[model samples]
Target: MMSKNPNLTLTGPDLAALLCSRVCHDVISPVGAINNGLELLDEGGADSDAMDLIRTSALNASVRLKFARLAFGASGSVGASIDTGEAERAAKDFAVAEKKTEVIWNGPRAIVAKNRVKLLLNLFLVAYSSIPRGGTLELTLENPEFDAKFKIVARGKLMRVPAKFVEITSGQVEEAIDAHSIQPYYTVLLAEECGMELGHSATGEEIIFTAESVSV
Candidate 1:
């Protein structure tokens, strides 16, 4: 008989590349639309409403670009330390228009590992999914050395973890069921690869996921 717990494994670099690709793929269209709108603005006669739309689209594209830098690029990778302020701002920028979720950061500033950066992006995506009607998300990073933990708490009107997400995070599922499904599963896999355990808990109005280092 097969063991109940089979090994879940993935390389950090590999996952980061995949995530970067995914983010780029998703943002390219909106960015292109922004470019197209700008071109239209340059060619079209001046109209207040049309100009407003162009400005709005340009702003949206800019925000998305900044978010992509943090989520997929090296916004957090500078010198030997990651700027917590920059990372927090980048995260907040992404959710600025998202009334459902607010990102709150609480932790000391330190250089986070590349893998940690990737994990944080994935966590942000997961938290985004939990808040469909506006909510607050609190994130705390503890310990930055060999042993580290990231705690994410999402509070909102409907902050319950779906069954499929739980299964994916716990290694109970293996296939991606939908576009919004893979992040959590891959997050858990990344945690496991880094010798960490991803723990999850949910209450009536809150849901929490903690990724902590585990001794091998």
Candidate 2:
């Protein structure tokens, strides 16, 4: 565990760079596998296995890239609404990446403000990462219109919650926003921007995240 920095504030470019680095970290494995598969094909081995490897790696890379886009990218126009169905699809695809996590998204297909949806997806990132050994994520929504609120229930074996997670997410620690700690801070930022407040709690086997709209 790294020591907390109370004065942590990241410049726009620095934050962008770290986020790009995180996305690269995710896609690198599958992209590297694809390259390896291609190199094997070039070495005069035209086995079905090589082709299968390439196909699978390509799909994995694609799925991860899509997830990153919605999770971190500027998804749509300013003040535009994103289809809840799209967010659900992204979450489901991301969970299936390891075949170890199951996602039960009860969020309907209502259109939501882009920032709200981004907040939801980013919360998913934080929740999913807490369960290192993989688990189940159930997303339930409330008042999906203007006063949108949601809860994420994460369950798994041996769940790990850093004491600093809540601190960072609530903007308590401002001095440390590295690759490892950026997502939670980012989630907090989004919530604040969207007039929402976040809460988190954990037990031995379950972690719950709740975000509710508040008067700003």
Candidate 3:
């Protein structure tokens, strides 16, 4: 899954396109399953158990699609702001949807640029990856103003950070970036584009992220 990085440099448009493709790739299988379930219902008549299973599967797929749309895809106009309430719901749903991590958001309701929400969601995934079995991720905001500082704390029994992901975020391993490591790399790029600075630290049982406005 090599990214189209011309001149060995990933551009904004390249990352955007890659993320869009990634989300689509993830949602396609579940969506296709839902479609298949629908076809089965049409042909098989009223089967209660089968209908119940299909309903649950459809709901799961819908939740995932919504989460992917908010987290990876563009939510609105280029410079438009998104409601933090909506972002919070999407993040919580996404975290629970995976059934691997539980998220606790501690912040006030405030509007921020959609890019910041995108960065936040990407950071969530990074933290989620640290936990092998299951874990708790706590996202906190130091300030809920237009230009705010946020922190992400993830804790689990086994926490492992991938070197490639760290390197990509630091812009240290540009040539090694592929579809798997692109999210972390793109998170860093998007943060900088939105005038923010991002840093991460990891311990044996935890990984912490700190992001603040560069304008500060």
Candidate 4:
């Protein structure tokens, strides 16, 4: 939906605000359910049901927070690298939070640059979006230390790539950036900043996202 635009402009504060809103949007539902469960218990409704809701909602909140931390937070100082094992846990947890996607992580347990991990998480989110009817998210990193390439396959009963999502990821957006598009936008930004080539395509029921490091 979008072509490469090196000047996809967004102010630093605005991007931060939108991404914050996006993270809040993701956690609000589960957090609200937690509050609802508590109120139900206060009303003396079926304690079993209330407790179940509270427990599940709490776990969901925890999972989402973990994913957000890796996907959006500054994990460390400059030049920091994250362990691939940790990235795998975040990816797997995010899929669980969605309740319909399964994550297959084949990346090594070695350390990878922070930007690389962030881009990986964002691509996982993109693939998750494509599979609306529950699916498998197969993510891989080949040769992490040198000639690194990341691949994510999204396969499902029903799959779609939003025109806007494609536009943002491909760096072709001329419109104002909003929370809906910020995730992909950030993914592309990270790829560009890290000298990683970003691309995506769909085949039959599968949507594939890839990023490859480019030599200087």
Question: How many clashes would you count in candidate 4?
Answer: 1
Model 4 residue runs over 4 Å out of place are 1-4
Residue pairs in candidate 4 whose N, alpha carbon or C atoms collide under 3 angstroms: 2-167
lDDT of 2 by residue, 1-216 (tens): 221333346678998898888889899999999999989999978778889999888988998999888889988777888888889999899888667899998856798888888899998888888788898999998887778888999998878765456777644764566777777767777877778888888887689998999975
Instruction: Output the better candidate (3/4) by TM-score.
Output: 4
lDDT against the true structure, each candidate: 0.67, 0.82, 0.75, 0.84
lDDT of 3 by residue, 1-216 (tens): 333322236766777777777777767776776677777788885677667667766776788788777777778877888788887888788766667788899988888788888878777777777776878989997665667788889898878775666776655674655677777777776677667777888877688987888765
As for lDDT, the candidate ahead, 1 or 2, is 2
Model 4's C-alpha root-mean-square deviation from the true structure amounts to 2.7
**Runs of candidate 1 exceeding 4 Å displacement:** 1-21, 32-46, 73-81, 97-100, 162-164, 174-179
lDDT of 1 by residue, 46-132 (tens): 566556656666666677777666655655435334555667777787777433467888888776666666667667767767767
User: Pick by lDDT: which candidate is best?
Assistant: 4
Worst 10 residues of 4 by lDDT: 1-10
Clash totals, every prediction: 2, 2, 0, 1
- Estimated TM-score per prediction? 0.75, 0.89, 0.83, 0.94
The top-ranked prediction according to TM-score is 4
Evaluated at residue 33, the lDDT of candidate 1 is 62
Q: Report lDDT (Cα) of residue 179, candidate 2.
A: 79
TM-score of predicted model 2? 0.89
lDDT at residue 185 of model 2 (Cα atoms): 68
